[model samples]
Target: MGAWVTRALRNFNVENRAERELSKMKPLSAPRHPSTKSLLQEQMSRHPEIEGEIARKDDKLLSLLRDVYVNSKDPVSLKVKDAGVLQESKEFRLPIGHHFEMMNIKSIPKGKISIVEALTLLNNHKLYPETWTAKKIAEEYQLELKDVNSLLKYFVTYEVKVFPAKDKKALQPK
Candidate 1:
Protein backbone atom coordinates (compact mmCIF):
# COMPACT_ATOMS: atom_id res chain seq x y z
CA MET A 1 0.00 0.00 0.00
CA GLY A 2 2.82 2.43 0.84
CA ALA A 3 4.65 1.79 -2.43
CA TRP A 4 1.37 2.13 -4.44
CA VAL A 5 0.64 5.52 -2.75
CA THR A 6 4.12 6.91 -3.55
CA ARG A 7 3.85 5.71 -7.17
CA ALA A 8 0.41 7.38 -7.58
CA LEU A 9 1.73 10.71 -6.15
CA ARG A 10 4.77 10.62 -8.48
CA ASN A 11 2.54 9.98 -11.52
CA PHE A 12 0.19 12.86 -10.53
CA ASN A 13 3.16 15.26 -10.09
CA VAL A 14 4.59 14.28 -13.48
CA GLU A 15 1.18 14.81 -15.20
CA ASN A 16 0.78 18.26 -13.45
CA ARG A 17 4.32 19.29 -14.54
CA ALA A 18 3.52 18.39 -18.16
CA GLU A 19 0.32 20.48 -17.95
CA ARG A 20 2.22 23.44 -16.42
CA GLU A 21 4.84 23.35 -19.18
CA LEU A 22 2.11 23.32 -21.84
CA SER A 23 0.40 26.33 -20.18
CA LYS A 24 3.73 28.28 -20.10
CA MET A 25 4.31 27.83 -23.89
CA LYS A 26 3.21 30.66 -26.21
CA PRO A 27 0.10 30.08 -28.40
CA LEU A 28 0.53 29.94 -32.21
CA SER A 29 -0.49 33.22 -33.89
CA ALA A 30 -3.48 33.30 -36.29
CA PRO A 31 -2.90 33.98 -40.03
CA ARG A 32 -3.07 37.70 -40.91
CA HIS A 33 -5.35 39.36 -43.52
CA PRO A 34 -4.61 42.76 -45.13
CA SER A 35 -6.23 45.73 -43.29
CA THR A 36 -9.34 47.45 -44.77
CA LYS A 37 -7.33 50.67 -45.35
CA SER A 38 -4.76 48.85 -47.50
CA LEU A 39 -7.48 46.95 -49.38
CA LEU A 40 -9.38 50.18 -50.10
CA GLN A 41 -6.17 51.88 -51.33
CA GLU A 42 -5.48 49.00 -53.70
CA GLN A 43 -9.07 49.08 -55.02
CA MET A 44 -8.93 52.87 -55.59
CA SER A 45 -5.60 52.53 -57.45
CA ARG A 46 -7.09 49.83 -59.67
CA HIS A 47 -10.23 51.89 -60.51
CA PRO A 48 -9.41 55.63 -60.70
CA GLU A 49 -12.64 56.31 -62.72
CA ILE A 50 -14.66 55.01 -59.71
CA GLU A 51 -13.24 57.86 -57.60
CA GLY A 52 -14.39 60.50 -60.15
CA GLU A 53 -17.87 58.87 -60.40
CA ILE A 54 -18.20 58.83 -56.59
CA ALA A 55 -17.23 62.55 -56.41
CA ARG A 56 -19.85 63.45 -59.05
CA LYS A 57 -22.58 61.53 -57.18
CA ASP A 58 -21.58 63.18 -53.88
CA ASP A 59 -21.83 66.69 -55.48
CA LYS A 60 -25.31 65.90 -56.88
CA LEU A 61 -26.49 64.58 -53.49
CA LEU A 62 -25.12 67.71 -51.72
CA SER A 63 -26.96 70.04 -54.14
CA LEU A 64 -30.24 68.12 -53.71
CA LEU A 65 -29.84 68.25 -49.90
CA ARG A 66 -29.16 72.03 -50.03
CA ASP A 67 -32.29 72.55 -52.18
CA VAL A 68 -34.36 70.51 -49.70
CA TYR A 69 -32.99 72.57 -46.78
CA VAL A 70 -33.83 75.84 -48.52
CA ASN A 71 -37.36 74.61 -49.37
CA SER A 72 -37.87 73.41 -45.74
CA LYS A 73 -36.82 76.85 -44.43
CA ASP A 74 -39.85 78.41 -46.30
CA PRO A 75 -42.91 77.47 -44.19
CA VAL A 76 -45.30 78.07 -47.16
CA SER A 77 -43.76 75.11 -49.06
CA LEU A 78 -45.01 72.73 -46.33
CA LYS A 79 -48.80 72.12 -46.36
CA VAL A 80 -49.04 72.13 -42.55
CA LYS A 81 -49.65 75.71 -41.29
CA ASP A 82 -49.29 75.22 -37.52
CA ALA A 83 -48.52 71.94 -35.69
CA GLY A 84 -51.80 72.36 -33.75
CA VAL A 85 -53.71 72.65 -37.05
CA LEU A 86 -52.40 69.23 -38.12
CA GLN A 87 -53.64 67.65 -34.89
CA GLU A 88 -57.00 69.46 -35.11
CA SER A 89 -57.56 68.47 -38.78
CA LYS A 90 -57.89 64.75 -37.99
CA GLU A 91 -60.84 63.35 -35.96
CA PHE A 92 -59.90 60.79 -33.30
CA ARG A 93 -63.35 60.28 -31.73
CA LEU A 94 -64.26 56.60 -31.40
CA PRO A 95 -67.60 55.27 -32.69
CA ILE A 96 -69.81 54.70 -29.66
CA GLY A 97 -73.10 52.73 -29.35
CA HIS A 98 -73.38 51.02 -32.78
CA HIS A 99 -69.74 49.83 -32.78
CA PHE A 100 -70.33 47.77 -29.65
CA GLU A 101 -73.40 46.13 -31.23
CA MET A 102 -71.34 45.22 -34.30
CA MET A 103 -68.62 43.75 -32.09
CA ASN A 104 -71.16 41.55 -30.27
CA ILE A 105 -72.38 40.18 -33.64
CA LYS A 106 -68.84 39.05 -34.48
CA SER A 107 -68.32 35.29 -34.00
CA ILE A 108 -66.14 34.17 -31.12
CA PRO A 109 -62.83 32.56 -32.20
CA LYS A 110 -62.39 28.79 -31.77
CA GLY A 111 -61.21 27.39 -28.40
CA LYS A 112 -62.13 30.65 -26.62
CA ILE A 113 -65.32 31.80 -24.91
CA SER A 114 -66.11 35.04 -23.04
CA ILE A 115 -66.15 35.07 -19.19
CA VAL A 116 -69.93 35.28 -19.08
CA GLU A 117 -70.18 32.42 -21.58
CA ALA A 118 -67.69 30.37 -19.51
CA LEU A 119 -69.68 30.99 -16.32
CA THR A 120 -72.92 30.08 -18.11
CA LEU A 121 -71.36 26.90 -19.48
CA LEU A 122 -70.09 25.90 -16.05
CA ASN A 123 -73.49 26.60 -14.47
CA ASN A 124 -75.33 24.59 -17.11
CA HIS A 125 -72.92 21.68 -16.82
CA LYS A 126 -73.29 21.67 -13.05
CA LEU A 127 -77.09 21.96 -13.10
CA TYR A 128 -77.61 19.42 -15.89
CA PRO A 129 -74.57 17.16 -15.95
CA GLU A 130 -76.22 14.53 -18.13
CA THR A 131 -77.63 17.02 -20.66
CA TRP A 132 -74.49 19.24 -20.84
CA THR A 133 -71.75 16.58 -20.92
CA ALA A 134 -68.17 17.54 -21.90
CA LYS A 135 -68.77 16.26 -25.47
CA LYS A 136 -71.93 18.31 -25.89
CA ILE A 137 -70.39 21.42 -24.38
CA ALA A 138 -67.31 21.13 -26.58
CA GLU A 139 -69.46 20.78 -29.70
CA GLU A 140 -71.67 23.73 -28.74
CA TYR A 141 -68.79 26.04 -27.77
CA GLN A 142 -66.45 24.98 -30.62
CA LEU A 143 -63.80 23.96 -28.05
CA GLU A 144 -61.69 20.81 -27.87
CA LEU A 145 -63.41 17.97 -26.01
CA LYS A 146 -60.33 17.45 -23.81
CA ASP A 147 -60.40 21.11 -22.71
CA VAL A 148 -64.09 20.80 -21.84
CA ASN A 149 -63.42 17.62 -19.85
CA SER A 150 -60.58 19.31 -17.93
CA LEU A 151 -62.74 22.37 -17.27
CA LEU A 152 -65.59 20.21 -15.98
CA LYS A 153 -63.20 18.10 -13.90
CA TYR A 154 -61.33 20.95 -12.18
CA PHE A 155 -63.38 24.21 -12.04
CA VAL A 156 -66.47 25.09 -10.01
CA THR A 157 -68.67 28.16 -9.49
CA TYR A 158 -68.62 30.15 -6.23
CA GLU A 159 -70.34 28.05 -3.49
CA VAL A 160 -71.45 30.02 -0.43
CA LYS A 161 -71.81 27.76 2.60
CA VAL A 162 -73.50 29.34 5.57
CA PHE A 163 -72.16 27.91 8.84
CA PRO A 164 -74.28 28.37 12.00
CA ALA A 165 -72.69 30.28 14.89
CA LYS A 166 -70.72 28.15 17.34
CA ASP A 167 -72.87 29.30 20.27
CA LYS A 168 -76.67 29.01 20.10
CA LYS A 169 -77.04 32.38 21.79
CA ALA A 170 -75.11 34.07 18.92
CA LEU A 171 -77.65 32.72 16.43
CA GLN A 172 -80.60 34.43 18.15
CA PRO A 173 -81.75 37.76 16.68
CA LYS A 174 -80.86 40.66 18.93
Candidate 2:
Protein backbone atom coordinates (compact mmCIF):
# COMPACT_ATOMS: atom_id res chain seq x y z
CA MET A 1 0.00 0.00 0.00
CA GLY A 2 1.13 3.57 -0.65
CA ALA A 3 2.20 5.78 2.24
CA TRP A 4 -0.93 7.96 2.17
CA VAL A 5 -3.29 4.99 2.03
CA THR A 6 -1.43 3.49 4.94
CA ARG A 7 -1.95 6.77 6.77
CA ALA A 8 -5.61 6.90 5.77
CA LEU A 9 -6.08 3.37 7.14
CA ARG A 10 -5.11 4.81 10.50
CA ASN A 11 -8.66 6.13 10.66
CA PHE A 12 -9.79 2.56 11.08
CA ASN A 13 -8.71 0.50 14.04
CA VAL A 14 -8.97 -2.67 12.04
CA GLU A 15 -6.22 -1.60 9.73
CA ASN A 16 -4.15 -4.67 10.46
CA ARG A 17 -7.07 -7.03 10.06
CA ALA A 18 -8.38 -5.36 6.93
CA GLU A 19 -4.90 -5.32 5.51
CA ARG A 20 -4.45 -9.00 6.27
CA GLU A 21 -7.71 -9.88 4.61
CA LEU A 22 -7.05 -7.58 1.73
CA SER A 23 -3.68 -9.14 1.16
CA LYS A 24 -5.31 -12.53 1.00
CA MET A 25 -7.94 -11.37 -1.46
CA LYS A 26 -7.51 -11.75 -5.19
CA PRO A 27 -6.41 -8.85 -7.32
CA LEU A 28 -8.96 -7.03 -9.45
CA SER A 29 -9.20 -8.07 -13.11
CA ALA A 30 -8.34 -5.39 -15.64
CA PRO A 31 -11.27 -3.62 -17.29
CA ARG A 32 -11.57 -4.66 -20.92
CA HIS A 33 -13.18 -1.43 -22.06
CA PRO A 34 -12.17 2.05 -21.00
CA SER A 35 -15.79 3.14 -20.58
CA THR A 36 -16.30 0.17 -18.24
CA LYS A 37 -13.06 0.73 -16.43
CA SER A 38 -14.28 2.20 -13.16
CA LEU A 39 -16.78 1.14 -10.55
CA LEU A 40 -16.93 4.77 -9.43
CA GLN A 41 -18.08 5.76 -12.89
CA GLU A 42 -20.85 3.18 -12.88
CA GLN A 43 -21.88 4.43 -9.46
CA MET A 44 -21.95 8.07 -10.56
CA SER A 45 -23.66 7.29 -13.84
CA ARG A 46 -26.34 5.70 -11.69
CA HIS A 47 -26.66 8.75 -9.42
CA PRO A 48 -25.34 11.88 -11.11
CA GLU A 49 -26.35 14.28 -8.33
CA ILE A 50 -24.19 12.48 -5.79
CA GLU A 51 -21.19 14.38 -7.11
CA GLY A 52 -21.79 17.43 -4.91
CA GLU A 53 -21.94 15.70 -1.51
CA ILE A 54 -19.22 15.77 1.17
CA ALA A 55 -17.42 12.92 2.93
CA ARG A 56 -18.16 13.74 6.57
CA LYS A 57 -21.30 11.67 7.02
CA ASP A 58 -19.62 8.77 5.26
CA ASP A 59 -16.73 9.15 7.66
CA LYS A 60 -19.17 9.05 10.54
CA LEU A 61 -20.70 5.86 9.29
CA LEU A 62 -17.28 4.27 8.94
CA SER A 63 -16.47 5.35 12.49
CA LEU A 64 -19.62 3.74 13.76
CA LEU A 65 -19.14 0.46 11.93
CA ARG A 66 -15.52 0.35 12.88
CA ASP A 67 -16.44 1.02 16.49
CA VAL A 68 -18.63 -2.01 16.44
CA TYR A 69 -16.07 -4.30 14.85
CA VAL A 70 -12.67 -2.87 15.67
CA ASN A 71 -12.50 -0.20 18.39
CA SER A 72 -15.01 -1.95 20.58
CA LYS A 73 -12.83 -5.05 20.38
CA ASP A 74 -15.93 -6.97 19.48
CA PRO A 75 -15.52 -7.82 15.84
CA VAL A 76 -17.87 -10.73 16.39
CA SER A 77 -20.40 -8.98 18.58
CA LEU A 78 -20.73 -5.90 16.46
CA LYS A 79 -24.41 -5.43 16.09
CA VAL A 80 -25.80 -2.62 13.99
CA LYS A 81 -28.86 -1.16 15.71
CA ASP A 82 -31.29 -1.16 12.78
CA ALA A 83 -29.63 -3.59 10.43
CA GLY A 84 -31.56 -6.75 9.76
CA VAL A 85 -28.50 -8.80 8.82
CA LEU A 86 -26.51 -7.66 11.81
CA GLN A 87 -29.47 -8.40 14.02
CA GLU A 88 -29.79 -11.81 12.51
CA SER A 89 -26.13 -12.70 12.63
CA LYS A 90 -25.02 -13.99 15.98
CA GLU A 91 -21.36 -13.66 15.14
CA PHE A 92 -19.07 -10.67 15.33
CA ARG A 93 -19.26 -8.46 12.25
CA LEU A 94 -16.41 -8.36 9.81
CA PRO A 95 -15.72 -5.40 7.56
CA ILE A 96 -17.38 -6.96 4.60
CA GLY A 97 -18.65 -5.44 1.34
CA HIS A 98 -22.24 -6.33 2.18
CA HIS A 99 -22.62 -3.41 4.58
CA PHE A 100 -21.05 -0.97 2.13
CA GLU A 101 -23.40 -2.18 -0.55
CA MET A 102 -26.32 -1.74 1.81
CA MET A 103 -25.08 1.80 2.37
CA ASN A 104 -24.56 2.53 -1.33
CA ILE A 105 -20.79 2.88 -1.14
CA LYS A 106 -17.79 0.66 -1.55
CA SER A 107 -14.16 0.52 -0.58
CA ILE A 108 -11.79 1.63 -3.29
CA PRO A 109 -10.22 -1.38 -4.92
CA LYS A 110 -7.07 -2.95 -3.46
CA GLY A 111 -4.64 -0.79 -5.42
CA LYS A 112 -6.80 2.02 -6.77
CA ILE A 113 -7.51 4.47 -3.92
CA SER A 114 -4.98 7.28 -4.05
CA ILE A 115 -4.27 10.89 -3.12
CA VAL A 116 -5.34 12.50 -6.39
CA GLU A 117 -8.81 10.93 -6.45
CA ALA A 118 -9.13 11.60 -2.74
CA LEU A 119 -8.59 15.31 -3.30
CA THR A 120 -11.09 15.58 -6.13
CA LEU A 121 -13.91 13.97 -4.18
CA LEU A 122 -13.06 15.80 -0.98
CA ASN A 123 -12.66 19.23 -2.50
CA ASN A 124 -15.48 19.04 -5.03
CA HIS A 125 -18.04 16.84 -3.32
CA LYS A 126 -17.32 18.27 0.11
CA LEU A 127 -18.72 21.52 -1.24
CA TYR A 128 -22.23 20.03 -1.24
CA PRO A 129 -22.45 18.41 2.17
CA GLU A 130 -26.09 18.29 3.31
CA THR A 131 -27.45 18.63 -0.19
CA TRP A 132 -26.32 15.16 -1.30
CA THR A 133 -29.23 13.00 -2.27
CA ALA A 134 -28.44 9.42 -1.18
CA LYS A 135 -31.65 8.07 -2.67
CA LYS A 136 -30.59 9.31 -6.06
CA ILE A 137 -27.13 7.79 -5.83
CA ALA A 138 -28.67 4.58 -4.56
CA GLU A 139 -30.96 4.43 -7.56
CA GLU A 140 -27.92 4.55 -9.77
CA TYR A 141 -26.20 1.86 -7.72
CA GLN A 142 -29.33 -0.25 -7.52
CA LEU A 143 -28.59 -0.51 -3.83
CA GLU A 144 -29.42 1.07 -0.48
CA LEU A 145 -28.14 4.54 0.50
CA LYS A 146 -26.42 3.60 3.71
CA ASP A 147 -23.03 5.05 2.84
CA VAL A 148 -23.28 5.69 -0.89
CA ASN A 149 -22.92 9.46 -0.84
CA SER A 150 -19.57 9.48 0.84
CA LEU A 151 -18.24 6.52 -1.13
CA LEU A 152 -19.21 8.20 -4.39
CA LYS A 153 -17.39 11.32 -3.25
CA TYR A 154 -14.31 9.22 -2.63
CA PHE A 155 -14.66 7.67 -6.06
CA VAL A 156 -15.07 11.10 -7.66
CA THR A 157 -12.09 12.44 -5.76
CA TYR A 158 -10.09 9.64 -7.33
CA GLU A 159 -11.32 10.42 -10.88
CA VAL A 160 -13.03 7.06 -11.35
CA LYS A 161 -14.73 8.17 -14.57
CA VAL A 162 -18.02 8.52 -12.78
CA PHE A 163 -20.06 10.58 -15.19
CA PRO A 164 -20.95 14.12 -14.18
CA ALA A 165 -23.73 16.32 -15.47
CA LYS A 166 -22.15 19.29 -17.20
CA ASP A 167 -22.70 22.34 -15.03
CA LYS A 168 -23.82 25.56 -16.68
CA LYS A 169 -21.16 28.21 -16.95
CA ALA A 170 -21.25 30.71 -14.11
CA LEU A 171 -22.86 34.04 -14.99
CA GLN A 172 -20.39 36.88 -15.43
CA PRO A 173 -19.98 39.14 -12.42
CA LYS A 174 -19.72 42.25 -14.58
Candidate 3:
Protein backbone atom coordinates (compact mmCIF):
# COMPACT_ATOMS: atom_id res chain seq x y z
CA MET A 1 0.00 0.00 0.00
CA GLY A 2 2.90 2.39 0.73
CA ALA A 3 4.59 1.56 -2.60
CA TRP A 4 1.37 2.11 -4.52
CA VAL A 5 0.81 5.46 -2.79
CA THR A 6 4.41 6.58 -3.47
CA ARG A 7 4.07 5.68 -7.21
CA ALA A 8 0.80 7.62 -7.48
CA LEU A 9 2.40 10.73 -5.90
CA ARG A 10 5.34 10.54 -8.35
CA ASN A 11 2.95 10.27 -11.34
CA PHE A 12 0.94 13.26 -10.11
CA ASN A 13 4.11 15.37 -9.79
CA VAL A 14 5.17 14.44 -13.37
CA GLU A 15 1.73 15.37 -14.76
CA ASN A 16 1.79 18.78 -13.01
CA ARG A 17 5.34 19.47 -14.31
CA ALA A 18 4.24 18.54 -17.82
CA GLU A 19 1.24 20.87 -17.60
CA ARG A 20 3.47 23.74 -16.41
CA GLU A 21 5.95 23.15 -19.23
CA LEU A 22 3.12 23.12 -21.78
CA SER A 23 1.72 26.35 -20.37
CA LYS A 24 5.13 28.05 -20.62
CA MET A 25 5.64 26.98 -24.30
CA LYS A 26 5.69 29.85 -26.76
CA PRO A 27 3.91 29.86 -30.18
CA LEU A 28 5.96 29.51 -33.40
CA SER A 29 5.65 32.67 -35.49
CA ALA A 30 6.92 33.61 -38.95
CA PRO A 31 9.55 36.36 -39.37
CA ARG A 32 8.06 39.83 -39.74
CA HIS A 33 8.86 42.12 -42.69
CA PRO A 34 10.38 45.56 -42.19
CA SER A 35 8.09 48.60 -41.82
CA THR A 36 6.92 50.29 -45.04
CA LYS A 37 8.89 53.49 -44.39
CA SER A 38 12.06 51.59 -43.67
CA LEU A 39 11.62 49.44 -46.76
CA LEU A 40 11.10 52.51 -48.95
CA GLN A 41 14.10 54.24 -47.42
CA GLU A 42 16.24 51.16 -47.98
CA GLN A 43 15.15 50.90 -51.58
CA MET A 44 15.77 54.60 -52.19
CA SER A 45 19.24 54.33 -50.73
CA ARG A 46 20.06 51.20 -52.73
CA HIS A 47 18.83 52.62 -56.03
CA PRO A 48 19.17 56.41 -56.45
CA GLU A 49 16.99 56.46 -59.58
CA ILE A 50 14.06 55.33 -57.41
CA GLU A 51 13.92 58.85 -55.88
CA GLY A 52 13.20 60.47 -59.25
CA GLU A 53 10.70 57.75 -60.08
CA ILE A 54 8.95 58.33 -56.80
CA ALA A 55 8.87 62.07 -57.43
CA ARG A 56 7.35 61.52 -60.89
CA LYS A 57 4.76 59.17 -59.45
CA ASP A 58 3.90 61.74 -56.77
CA ASP A 59 3.53 64.43 -59.47
CA LYS A 60 1.18 62.22 -61.48
CA LEU A 61 -0.87 61.51 -58.37
CA LEU A 62 -1.05 65.24 -57.59
CA SER A 63 -2.18 66.06 -61.16
CA LEU A 64 -4.85 63.33 -61.03
CA LEU A 65 -6.08 64.67 -57.67
CA ARG A 66 -6.21 68.22 -59.06
CA ASP A 67 -8.26 67.08 -62.06
CA VAL A 68 -10.66 65.13 -59.86
CA TYR A 69 -11.18 68.00 -57.41
CA VAL A 70 -11.54 70.66 -60.12
CA ASN A 71 -13.95 68.64 -62.25
CA SER A 72 -16.03 67.33 -59.37
CA LYS A 73 -16.32 70.62 -57.47
CA ASP A 74 -16.88 72.94 -60.41
CA PRO A 75 -18.35 71.12 -63.39
CA VAL A 76 -18.51 72.89 -66.77
CA SER A 77 -19.82 71.76 -70.15
CA LEU A 78 -17.73 72.65 -73.17
CA LYS A 79 -19.62 74.39 -75.96
CA VAL A 80 -18.38 75.06 -79.48
CA LYS A 81 -20.30 78.21 -80.36
CA ASP A 82 -18.38 79.01 -83.52
CA ALA A 83 -19.62 75.73 -85.00
CA GLY A 84 -23.22 76.94 -84.58
CA VAL A 85 -24.10 74.13 -82.22
CA LEU A 86 -26.76 75.46 -79.88
CA GLN A 87 -29.34 73.97 -77.57
CA GLU A 88 -32.89 73.85 -78.93
CA SER A 89 -34.74 76.85 -77.55
CA LYS A 90 -37.76 78.71 -78.97
CA GLU A 91 -37.30 81.78 -76.78
CA PHE A 92 -34.29 83.72 -75.41
CA ARG A 93 -33.59 83.71 -71.68
CA LEU A 94 -31.87 86.28 -69.49
CA PRO A 95 -28.48 85.42 -68.00
CA ILE A 96 -28.47 85.03 -64.23
CA GLY A 97 -25.80 87.20 -62.53
CA HIS A 98 -23.54 85.92 -59.73
CA HIS A 99 -24.64 82.34 -60.21
CA PHE A 100 -21.33 80.85 -61.29
CA GLU A 101 -18.75 79.37 -58.90
CA MET A 102 -15.30 80.87 -58.54
CA MET A 103 -12.58 78.92 -60.34
CA ASN A 104 -9.12 78.12 -58.90
CA ILE A 105 -6.55 80.37 -60.48
CA LYS A 106 -2.82 79.57 -60.46
CA SER A 107 -0.53 82.58 -60.58
CA ILE A 108 2.34 82.58 -63.07
CA PRO A 109 5.21 85.02 -62.73
CA LYS A 110 5.99 86.86 -66.01
CA GLY A 111 3.85 84.46 -68.00
CA LYS A 112 0.79 84.64 -70.27
CA ILE A 113 -2.35 85.85 -68.54
CA SER A 114 -4.96 83.24 -67.72
CA ILE A 115 -8.76 83.34 -68.06
CA VAL A 116 -9.09 83.74 -64.29
CA GLU A 117 -7.21 87.04 -64.42
CA ALA A 118 -9.41 88.30 -67.22
CA LEU A 119 -12.51 87.30 -65.29
CA THR A 120 -11.10 89.00 -62.21
CA LEU A 121 -10.54 92.19 -64.17
CA LEU A 122 -14.10 92.11 -65.42
CA ASN A 123 -15.46 91.31 -61.97
CA ASN A 124 -13.53 94.11 -60.25
CA HIS A 125 -15.25 96.82 -62.31
CA LYS A 126 -18.88 95.98 -61.66
CA LEU A 127 -19.88 99.62 -61.06
CA TYR A 128 -18.50 100.88 -64.38
CA PRO A 129 -19.91 99.46 -67.61
CA GLU A 130 -17.09 100.91 -69.75
CA THR A 131 -14.42 98.76 -68.00
CA TRP A 132 -16.35 95.56 -68.82
CA THR A 133 -15.27 95.67 -72.48
CA ALA A 134 -12.58 93.32 -73.80
CA LYS A 135 -10.41 96.24 -74.93
CA LYS A 136 -10.37 97.73 -71.47
CA ILE A 137 -9.63 94.38 -69.83
CA ALA A 138 -6.80 93.73 -72.25
CA GLU A 139 -5.25 97.13 -71.65
CA GLU A 140 -5.54 96.84 -67.91
CA TYR A 141 -4.07 93.35 -67.71
CA GLN A 142 -1.43 93.96 -70.43
CA LEU A 143 -2.89 91.11 -72.48
CA GLU A 144 -3.80 90.84 -76.13
CA LEU A 145 -7.33 91.77 -77.18
CA LYS A 146 -7.69 88.35 -78.78
CA ASP A 147 -6.75 86.64 -75.53
CA VAL A 148 -9.23 88.71 -73.55
CA ASN A 149 -11.96 88.10 -76.13
CA SER A 150 -11.33 84.40 -76.06
CA LEU A 151 -11.50 84.34 -72.26
CA LEU A 152 -14.75 86.34 -72.32
CA LYS A 153 -16.21 84.01 -74.91
CA TYR A 154 -15.26 80.99 -72.82
CA PHE A 155 -16.76 82.59 -69.72
CA VAL A 156 -20.05 83.34 -71.49
CA THR A 157 -20.33 79.86 -72.93
CA TYR A 158 -19.34 77.94 -69.83
CA GLU A 159 -20.11 80.11 -66.79
CA VAL A 160 -23.36 81.67 -68.05
CA LYS A 161 -26.37 79.51 -68.87
CA VAL A 162 -29.36 80.63 -70.91
CA PHE A 163 -32.81 79.78 -69.56
CA PRO A 164 -35.57 79.33 -72.12
CA ALA A 165 -39.09 80.72 -71.61
CA LYS A 166 -42.28 80.87 -73.71
CA ASP A 167 -42.31 84.68 -73.75
CA LYS A 168 -39.60 86.71 -75.52
CA LYS A 169 -40.30 90.02 -73.79
CA ALA A 170 -38.40 91.23 -70.70
CA LEU A 171 -39.94 90.60 -67.29
CA GLN A 172 -41.85 93.64 -66.01
CA PRO A 173 -42.26 94.50 -62.32
CA LYS A 174 -45.90 93.86 -61.41
Provide the overall lDDT of each model, using Cα atoms, as 2-decimal numbers. Answer: 0.74, 0.53, 0.59
Clashing pairs in 3: none
TM-score of 2: 0.16
Higher TM-score: candidate 2 or 3? 3
Model 1: runs farther than 4 Å from truth? 1-34, 58-116, 127-131, 141-147, 153-155, 168-174
State the lDDT at 90 in candidate 1: 50
Output the worst ten-in-a-row residue range by lDDT, candidate 1: 91-100
What's the residue-level lDDT of 123 in candidate 1? Answer: 92
Residue 49 of candidate 2: its Cα lDDT?
Answer: 74
Could you tell which candidate, 1 or 3, scores higher by lDDT?
Answer: 1
The C-alpha local distance difference test score for the whole of candidate 1 amounts to 0.74
Instruction: Give me the overall lDDT of model 3.
Output: 0.59
Which residue pairs collide in model 2, if any?
41-162, 46-140, 76-92, 77-92, 103-146, 103-147, 104-148, 117-157, 117-158, 121-157
**Per-model TM against the reference:** 0.40, 0.16, 0.24
lDDT of 2 by residue, 8-45 (tens): 87777776887899889698867578766697788888
Model 3 C-alpha lDDT per residue in residues 46-102, reported as the tens digit of each score = 999976775565767788888874335433345455334543322332222332335
Compared with the true structure, the alpha-carbon lDDT of candidate 2 equals 0.53
Specify the poorest-scoring 10-residue window by lDDT in model 3.
88-97
Between candidates 1 and 2, the TM-score winner: 1
